[model samples]
Target: MTAIAEHKPAPPKPGTGGGDGGFIDLVLRFRELTILAALIVLVAVTTAVNPRFLSAQGVEDIFLNASILVLLAVGQTLVVVTRNIDLSVGSTVGLVAFVVGDFVTNSDHGLVVAVALGVGIGAVCGLVNGLLVSFCGVPALVVTLGTLYVIQGLNHYIAHGEQISAAEVPQSILDLGNGAILGVPYLPLISVVVMLLVGYYLRAYSSGREFYAIGSSPEAARLAGVPIRRRVLTAYLASGVLAGLAGTLWLARFGTVIADPAKGWELKVVAAVVVGGVAIVGGVGTVYGAALGALLITTIGSVLVVLKINSFWQEAIVGLLLLLAISADRLVALRLARVLRKRNARHG
Candidate 1:
């Protein structure tokens, strides 16, 4: 009289070409898809509310408005992909931007040189951040936070209550920012080119993927001889350079500069990156997605305008979107942890 034992189902395992893994991949892609859908819906709703919202000029304004954030978002994507953050980007942009007034109005340098100076200054700030974080073994958040204050202090000290006015700015440069080529604003076009190039690198290069590896598992990445420090430093440097570049463009677009220009943009850029679906935990998002995230944020503001939402509610909406993104990231982490545990159980 033998008793038959019941067979138990196998535990689901991630990376086994199984349904669970496929679902995770879908989740990763879902963020981008959601952004696209939201963009379409926002545009549709806004256009319905105000048909002029879809006007060609209005569309151009949206893209140009998003360009700076998009640049910062891409740079942030690089850093975040490696489990790092650069809180100094906004301050860096501000500091470099203060220089734009000097260059545009005081210096003999043309637009190109002005832009180069901004980038170089940004790189220096980045170098300070990178060296400290990599060689000093400081936590990235703390290091960036420290740099943020240092840079902001420097900005205020240098400005000493000075401001860069539109009359002092070159009309040529301002026109460059506003001018469209084949119907696309220059700023957005520049951003589009940058996003495409960065996206390609991340998608196609082995070294680019190293950023993800480091973020996915720093210990494992170190063991694999992935040169984690170098990658992380490079990420921060890239962030600085982009932020600086954005600063130059910012001056061009606005024709005005103050000591604290872009002072609050650091949070916005980080929010854009995270909301764009680049995992704050690192190694799971794209520059295009980040750019889309920037576009979505910008669109939200426009949507509010079209719908005549209270100005007070704008900040709340952005904050709520950011919170939602953070929550989504946390949920993704929990899902991954559960999958990893199941995989372990299957093996055990």
Candidate 2:
């Protein structure tokens, strides 16, 4: 009988580059590139359908419309990066927006104070969610879902069916949303600034890395002495503060606040983050991607208008885009898994 060679693993590849590793690194690190390509495609298509879609005013409209979602998505990205979710953002924004409106209309609070109060309230809500998730060891989904209803109910009770109209809002506060700097809307500018800071922190800071580490492998991060609990709590708190800021912007832009100002917004924010290439499971996304995702979602609505399609199709299109994005993510995961297995066998 012929002697059979033992089942030995192959030798490691020579170069540190090439094959699946490089591809995955490119996908993970340059997710923004994909988003940019998608955005370009969207713009091109829209412009083809309606040249007016590329007008300066049209561009401004898109950016302004996308700004709030961008802000919300950035916060969602942070929490999701840590393998957590915050379903309460919509309710948080609603509550805070109404609070700001109420303060501005019913009290002697200045614009600055009103803005601060809204953000503070949001931060406090976030802290509660964070504490429950971190200290109580509750899953983020369950915790946030519970808070979502609780916060919404609280908002309804506080508003007591009251609504603040544009006539009642201060000019200064409205300017926060309407004002433009260097020809760009202030809200979009603020979103850009926030994105820059968040992107830098995630890319360069140790604490920020802890989020990725935790998401990548919680057990490993814990063993490596990462303060998982504290960081996670901070993530949720940051999300809340951002949501509050978004609420204030909503108050300014809409010039009115009701208990349901941002109903169902949390889902949209999550969809934007996920569509932008952020991993739903966590630890693999960027602020840039989240911002791009927001832009893309906003563009979709504009595109629909340009195409003169029914407004009803907007939600359906968004759902379709979300499904495609999730499918793409699943494919990427499968390819990465295959690559890892092959590499392990080679090294074994």
Candidate 3:
């Protein structure tokens, strides 16, 4: 009898199927689910304590307050996912806010034009940081840290201790902040659209996958034919654009802008992103989670006020939540790593 040649089965991809892959997927999916559950619980508890918390007006207030931070957190999530950080966003927002205020007060610019200009300026600042980091081979952290000072200084010089009050802002612009659509605040609605766009891009696009790949393993992504430099630059540019957009929202919401607009906001933004489940080391996270995080933190602050807790507890509570988030991240990471190792061993 003639012997027939037998075909061998193809090996599974490193991050695919039947072994550690399933476990990893389960863990990641669960992490996101858990975060959602936590948010729901928090909302329920707060509403229970103060029934007014569930009222339409109260809900709108919470969302509106979280809107700017949500924007910042989303941008921060992208940067952090690429294993980089943008420390200048707070300052960038401040600079853009001040610039918009100046245009409105000192010039004859319309509200729409001023908003566009502010966002445009923010994009430019982000572009500068991206170029320095991507082309100059500088660390993102360092580049952004420097830009923070530069942007802040520029804001101060431009404002020259000047402040723009509500009177200076056009009624139309201020209205943008308070206006609602189908019972939803305009700011939050805009924020939701932004988050949805970003979520779809990251989850459904090839370029978005490349971002996760680069974050997962930069050298490997390069080896796999990913355009490392181009993607990194684009990531930073997107971040800047988002930051600028956030500044416009900030200007509208506050109806005033000063040299110190959004001062110390970067930390809060980062914290929100991290606590929302974005990995600090990169290659993992969802915008939905980050948005949830922003909501959670915002709610916490509101809850404190409603509960008549001292304001000092706000920082302390945030610190505690941050610590818990980091700890949880580490535990999840370790578990995933262990599962991977075991599967590799079994398959080999």
Strongest candidate by lDDT? 2
The CA lDDT of each predicted structure is 0.82, 0.84, 0.80
How well is each residue in 168-210 modelled by candidate 1, as lDDT tens digits?
Answer: 8877778777887887688988888988888887667767777
Residue range 1-348, candidate 2, lDDT tens digits: 222223322211111112354665577556668778878998998898788999999998999999999999999988997889999999999998988898898776667897789889989999999999988999999999999999999999998998989999988889988998787789999999999998888767777777777776676567666788998999999999999999999999999778868999998999899888787876677778888988988898888888989988878877887898888878887887888899899999
Runs in model 2 deviating more than 4 A are 1-21, 29-31
On residues 209-247, what C-alpha lDDT tens digit does candidate 3 reach at each position?
677777777776665666878878888888888888888
Regions more than 4 Å wrong, model 3: 1-21
1 or 3: which has the higher lDDT? 1
In angstroms, the error of model 1 at 14 is 17
Give the total clashing residue pairs for model 1: 0
- For every candidate in turn, the CA RMSD to the true structure comes to 7.3, 7.1, 5.3
